[model samples]
Target: MDTGPETGTGTSEQTTSQSARPGYKQLLRTADAWTFLLPGFAARQPFAMLTIGIVLLVQHTTGSYGSAGVVSAATGVSMALFAPQSGKLADRFGQGAVLLPGVLVHTAAIAALISLALAHAPLWALLAAAVPAGASVPQVGPMVRSRWAVKLNGSPLMSTAAAFESVTDEFTFVVGPVLATALCTSVHPAAGLVAEAALTLVGGLLFAAQRRTAPVPSRLAGGGTRHASALTVPGVRVLAIVFLGIGSVFGGMQVSLTAFTQAIGEPGINGLLYGTFAAGNMCAGVVCGAIAWKVTPQRRLLVAYPLLTLACSTLWAVHAVPLLGALGLLVGLCIAPSLITGYTLVESLVPAAARTEAFTWLTGAVALGQAAAATVSGQLADRFGASAGFLVPLGGTALALATLLTLRRRLSTTRQDG
Candidate 1:
């Protein structure tokens, strides 16, 4: 059966000799593609919805933004701390092995959280539970990307897959937070919590079930100690810095949205404002996918980084109500394409056995950066001005853009992406 993902037009018999060579359509049309990807899409809906629910639930329950922030930070920190090891594990024992542990841990964490809330446990205990819970982050999207890239014989299907993932990710973030916000405010917040638990269980399980899409373990690790090496590699380092800027812009934007909405006493407006940002990103990513760039991956970054920089920098001027949304939309427009490009490039540059670890490193970097950004942005908004807080991200985005330009010459393409 043909998978839902479409292929280009079929070739004439004259092209029959070329059948030995596979294209993206054929690869994506395979059983492995639909089995992995469709489930992945189904899984994303709740994945995003649950995460946003957790944040909102905890924040509302504790009535302390600091505690909420720490819990949120813990999730990122745990992911950052464990992703490399988890990724390496995926490389060693196949992606499915690590996924089981990750999801169980994640499910337990959410369940533990609900249980603690019912038991009225202290904040410290809550934090303790969260630490273990965060560690269970299933390496879903990255593993799928790597799996598909190999499935497609390393054709440009990788780019298409990345674009497809980006679009879904953007959609998930957009709808997830809004739905979570609504659920948290409704007559029952616990229902949202329960829903989150179910998702982590089902989504995590379905993803792990598709053995065909799991990475084939290598005899030896392609690269040693990705957590250490990702920082050392020039290209990884450059991309890491870009992720830092992305984290700051996104993290600060999140906090700012909440603050602004709460300030106006229409607290739910945060979802609306943030949704616009996601819409911009989705549109931007689709546009990028449509534009076929002959430029090298590194060169693509050269062009994209500046656009991303300008997008974030533009937020500094967002004092006007309409302009605030416009600036956010502009930033969103540039954000996903740049991120998708950078990540796709990273996938190509890193070795196959190390691909999982490499992606984890990238996710961790962005998460860590966002964690730091959230803490700092909260303080800045409290002390100086809410409007002025955007300057920090503006400056950071500029710095990231500069770093990418400086290292553009040394950037390496992932042989797999070739």
Candidate 2:
């Protein structure tokens, strides 16, 4: 298998190609790569909206941030728990087979949750509706990464693909939250979720229809034997844990920023503030992808992870909106390299057949961590104020960094393809 500079295990051919430092234009020109990328981007945008949309709508109805956070946490927890199973099914069958029904169910579920929230139903009823809403979230991001893995396998361009996809994901975050926040604040409290459902329906169907680009099912590809879960891999586990911490930054920021804006009688600024943070991530992704790095992905991750912790440590101390926006941007800037490096590392760490599942495990880890953090941060914000909620990202990253440090050696043992 061809490896890039990331693994430092590439053959001379890989080294020769790596010497030129492939760009995004080269990556996009690869055999209709843009076909799936566009629809996949639309399909995945709803994910960025789900938690924040839930929080916004529920908070508006319940008049309690804690309740809002709990409802959103329910959705996140269900998604994190069920997403891997969805990926496993996609791997065994095909992405289209899994995604078609997943999207339909997700749209219906989101509708139900929105109705339940609008009706001021009991928390139990809302939680019940949220379960399927999240559980059925189409695994578009993971599926897209799997598509790229198939398209660019054994090429130096795989790292470029990884970086590009991370940028796409970050870009969606930039657009999704701002759009959701705008729809909710300007239109109606439930407008964000309404748009989320509509997009999931339209975008999900469009993405699923592009079946030609889908990766081959593992069983059809002659890997019919029962494969263990990707989480069984120690390296995957470590990466998942690290991703969970990264998710905390997202969750904490969403709730804390909202509370901060609300506390200052400027509730509409939530989207702009969050957008600035996500913009930082997108900018860094562009820069990270454009660079021709000599360092291994593992080393890059080590350096980037610490910087994320350091950047997040200061978020709790700032009350000024301008400073908060600037600091949030800095925190955002620190995130993309870690995310890009982690995805790049997946190339050498897992076999081709289980690639989608591996991606989902990391994705699900982010959801789970975000869910837990949203719950904790919401409670903290409700009691102690928005500043207290910011602490979640700092503490979460610190713990994750420590774990990555101790288990750092496991990441070096890449899978040896024969």
Candidate 3:
């Protein structure tokens, strides 16, 4: 049976083999690609902003960093739990049907959260509002990447697209904190959350309207036989576990950096230090995208993972602010490439039907890792000082390296089959 292009994996593969290396200009010009990309970029801005916003709001209203930490943790946990379910829904239904409603609900909940905080609502009420707010956040990152996979599917341009997305992700993380902090401090404590809600709604709606590039629902693609969950796919669980370690590095770095800044009586410079870290990733991602590499994604990860481990290990020994900032930049250089490689591997491992869910699961693993790292590292910093907290990320990177080494054979097999 010859399915139409929308449902035809074979067609995508054929196109990929025949296509030449597409430069950035050529890729950008391909079929409303900017229209498709802009919304995703806008939608993702909130991912960086929300946690900071929540922390600031809670702290401002309640005068308790401990309470703020709990609220932020609750939000992360809710989003991590729900991200895969949201992706599964998008896979089963059309993106528009699933995304638009999810975005709306999530935005509304964020607005309500801001209002509750502003009104000085009961602590429980404020905490309760965060659940729905986080739960409803559309899995925009996964959905957008899925669109790129469908559009660019077997082509080399897919690597470029992934790199571009990684760069944007780095940009969002860098900017989100600065923007959130600026708004919360200079304008009003609620402004950051308000901006997040507005941007999410607008960006999500714009993204959903680009129906032409959205992946076909699994049911429609497969004539209603349920697709296997991405989790069921070989090697996916292992990849998720490795990504968890990677995420722990990120989470631990964040908490440790903040603690370090506070310890040095320069808490305000935390955003600057984070931007330095993200800047390194952004530059590296661009370079990675521009160059054509002969190495497979698995091999690329093997090299990058150890570099990350080395950079993070160095972080544990650095006490001077200037030296630590340079090390942070070095760590950033390793991060984007590793992430891009991971996304590329996920694409190869999972079937088209389960792509979004698989990607979301990877993201969820990172979130869980981050949450765990933050909790543990926070305590370590409190008890033994920020320098001791650096061990959390150092340990995380070491584990990631070990996992990559242990699973290289399985990963190679999956890539070969893919």
Candidate 4:
């Protein structure tokens, strides 16, 4: 079956070029890549919006920050557990097959979560639904990237695609939290969750129906006996560790900000604070996007990681109301680009056959990190205060950078030999 956006093409075709692919800059200006990607970017927004909105809704409902933390943690946990499985499913049948199902499952779960909250159901029940939700969360990032890569034939356009995804993500994050918070604060607290569910389901379906951008199903579902063993591959293993570290930092950043808000006597500003951080990330993404050059993925990471480390660790210097949040904003600017760079590197490093599974591994790593931070960071905040809670993630970020630096020698040598 024709699965990509160009459904009329009848079959998935391999049209890769032996010629040099366009640079990252020119890809953005190119008509084809943008046509495929722009819609994909638009499709991704609702997913982020709902995810953020629902988390806030659940957090507000339970009133126990711990319960809220657990519900949010469930999302990370579910996504971690199912990401590889979901990716494998994507690889096999088609990304569209997996995408729609995941979105539906997620939408249903969100509805259940809202209903559970309204019915005053136990937190335990809500947590159960969250598992399914996480398990089915959208594969948008990986799916879209994979399509772009295949479509663009390994062009520098891939980096531009990565930048586009990151930037779009930042845009979603910025709008998602603000809109979610605003909706939740309204007389109809339930409206936000419903809107999220609807958007996710509709968006997911719309994306799946867009044949131009979907993946061609190879004998993927039943034909190739590919490995869960992809997990065992050396480069993937290394990348997984990097993801784990980075995920911890991202997850920990959220928990820290939440804790920080409370500690500074302005818990109400939490959404706005996150929105600020997202704004900075969005700005960074735009800058990254405008640059048409492709710096080696490793070089980008090497430069970006240290900046992440520095920004994350330095927020403690402020004694002002919004200044701390402002510093946090500064810190977050490079975060999405760094992540985009990392994912781009991962995609470049992994084999095509293993792409979906590889992306899953990254998602799982992220989920694991977020869940752990939510579980631990909160308690740490309870004990030593929010500022101290942050130190753990900052330290983790530094350690991750160190690990990456240590591996740089081997990695650089390997890439050159190839």
User: Which candidate ranks first by lDDT, i.e. highest?
Assistant: 2
Model 1's lDDT to the true fold?
0.66
Question: Candidate 4's residue-wise lDDT over 1-418, tens digit each?
Answer: 1134454442323233223353445555433555546556656666445545545666567655456667777877888888888787777687777876677778888888888877768988988877887777776767777776666545555666677767777788788766766677664667766776776777777667766555656564336644344475566666676677766665666666766776677756767887888889888987776675557777887888788888877764455657877876886686876777766775556656567677778768867776766656656666677776567567667777788777764333132111
Better of 3 and 4 by lDDT: 3
Which residue pairs of candidate 4 clash? 4-211, 4-212, 5-211, 5-212, 5-213, 6-212, 25-292, 92-220, 92-221
Error of 4 at 386 (Å): 3.8
Window of ten residues with lowest summed lDDT in model 1: 1-10
lDDT, candidate 3, 1-418, per-residue tens: 2222355454754374337574566567555568778888998899888877776677679865446656766676788788888888888887888888888898888988888988999878887888888788777888888877776766777777788888888899889877887788778989989999989999988889988778888777778877778888657777787778877776777677767887898867877787788888888988888877789988898888888888888777789999989998998898888888888887778778788898898888777777667667766776788887689888887887787788777674353222
Runs of candidate 2 exceeding 4 Å displacement: 1-20, 416-418
- For model 3, name the residue pairs that clash: none
Residue 49 lDDT in candidate 1: 56
The number of the candidate with the highest TM-score is: 2
C-alpha lDDT values of all predictions: 0.66, 0.88, 0.78, 0.67
Local error of candidate 1 at 254, Å?
A: 1.7
Residue 124's C-alpha lDDT in candidate 3? 88
Instruction: Please give the distance, in angstroms, between residue 343's alpha carbon in candidate 3 and its true position after superposition.
Output: 0.6
Candidate 4 residues lying further than 4 Å off, grouped into runs, are 1-25, 28-39, 220-229, 262-268, 292-295, 316-319, 409-418
Backbone clash total, candidate 4: 9
